[model samples]
Target chain A: MKLRKSEDSENEVELNMTPMIDVVFLLIIFFMVVSELSTLNLEEIELPLADESEVLKSEKLDARHIICNVREDGTIRIQGNSYKKEQLADYLKVEADAEEREPANPSNPAVPPSKLYLTIRAHKDTKFENVQNVFDACSQNGIYKTRVMATKDE
Target chain B: MIARLLRRRPRSRSSRPKAVEEAKLELTPMIDCVFLLLIFFMCNLEFVKQDGLIKAFLPKDRGQSTGPSVTDLGEVRVKLLWCAPGTTIETEDRDVGEVVLKIEKNVYPRSGATPDWEMLYLDLVKMRDIRDRSGNPDALPVIIDARPLVPHAAVVGALNACVKARIKDVTFAAPERPF
Candidate 1:
């Protein structure tokens, strides 16, 4: 094979397409993974508006909390996976059982409570009965620490 | 010799620039496609909503109440219910509001007039002050009880009111429903 050399040796540079394409593909993959991971625990639900709400504090949002999502149709979801009402009860029971229960407060307690917290994200249009079901399930499991999610337009 | 050189055309030398052009890859199309993808991903990315949290306390009736719930406590109960039909109420969000906001004994009926949640919040603050004067300020647990048909927005609205009132002890009433 005869190599064709450019007579004026300025080295006619050939831009490599392989590495560029590789980087582009890697970027696409990165975005895909990041978007999926970011939205794993959250659902696309319209939160109710709150007149006055405190800004979320990072210390309050620790890794030990469970994010429970309730859709308008009363479907319960955890980590993007949908669960039935009975299944949710069973799930909470397991979580509650896993946590070490603290001594019951004499001032207001009938039983010892678990320290596990549950954050409920319910759609604004959802029926109160749906939220009640979740609240009841958490309470029955001894997970009394709970918070409801809302958004402020301002 | 001059005649022979002239007859031999300088084709390769004349088209050397064309050969160089062919040797280099055309990056414009690929770059265009890459930019399009970047724009697509950037536009597709959704920022999570700034959701605020309202803490809630749920009661567990395991057996019996121990000591009148945190010693002597002045409890405030807020009940929300769906309004009667034909009572057209529109909230600020343009949602047709039907939630009746009741704080203590004063009732803000959802009967045609818009129920002011802000007013209910103020009443809770006043009641909380009254309880504070009696010594158990932190023990004034505001229970928010809503009917089944009431929307979650209504419940959150009440919860928001309680939180804004700085009532530390807030509970959501999940009373046993009569089937």
Candidate 2:
């Protein structure tokens, strides 16, 4: 049998890898940035679902905000450190004092709210008392602004 | 000139094409390695989590007695109490108020056992519409005064209702225990 002649067999094709490498490097950078933003000091807990809950935005995410993870056992967890009910109050006062104090209330000039942004992340099944204690602690420390984290309802 | 444009001629008729002069590159290995790295990073990457929050600013009177004793109760106060099934507000187990919206004040069922979250939502919506007609939609600030032991879900439900009603401000109350 006679062999068939192939024209492409003699030509050497070189793919330019510059663009591919550039694209790859760009993808790597994108992932790195996203991972850095996701590395927040937060504890994982089951949050309740709410249809009208406000979605977390970049503006709402401040660098100095504290997250309190309350469990069914009534212990508050902050960045993996657990604080008892009694201890939470003291810890919160210290944290509140560290942040800038809010401007004095227009109605009540004597008691200014704390500038501390407190986010309460509690298990859905956890009793409200535990969360209330956190609020009470916040109130004692003059922190009035709070947001309870929840899952967005479909 | 036409032949040169249509087809490039070999320098020598008996020799190989001019392109064969450069060394051949083994692209398969490089492509495979690149894909492997991409897969590794893709597998390792974590997706950003999406969460919602129920916004609240506690009343100035919550934890301290030193604040002004003037109690600024909400015009529309939604109280969530903890009660058992088929039990009246008086008979509710105080240890854990499992999120019943109606007790004695919001007595819808008359039996007073079941909490009415929907009623709370409807009432707040009605309040919003009335305020809107009066041209002060944002004038009403709602206070969700949930008992200490009520389930957190119940409070969220109440807050969600107020938010849906487009209430301007929603606050929680730390009322003195009224046993």
Best model number under DockQ: 1
Model 2 ranges off by over 4 Å: A1-40, A58-63, A106-111, B1-45, B60-63, B66-74, B90-98, B109-116, B131-138, B175-179
Q: Per-residue lDDT for A5-71 in model 2, tens only?
A: 3455445374556567668767777766655544434555667778887776765456478878887
RMSD of each: 9.1, 9.3
Retained native contacts per candidate, as fractions?
A: 0.68, 0.60
How big is the positional error of residue B72 in model 2, measured in Å on the Cα after superposition? 5.4
Report clash pairs, candidate 1: none
TM-score of 1: 0.76
TM-score of chain B of each: 0.65, 0.57
Clashing pairs in 2: B82-B97
Top of the candidates by TM-score? 1
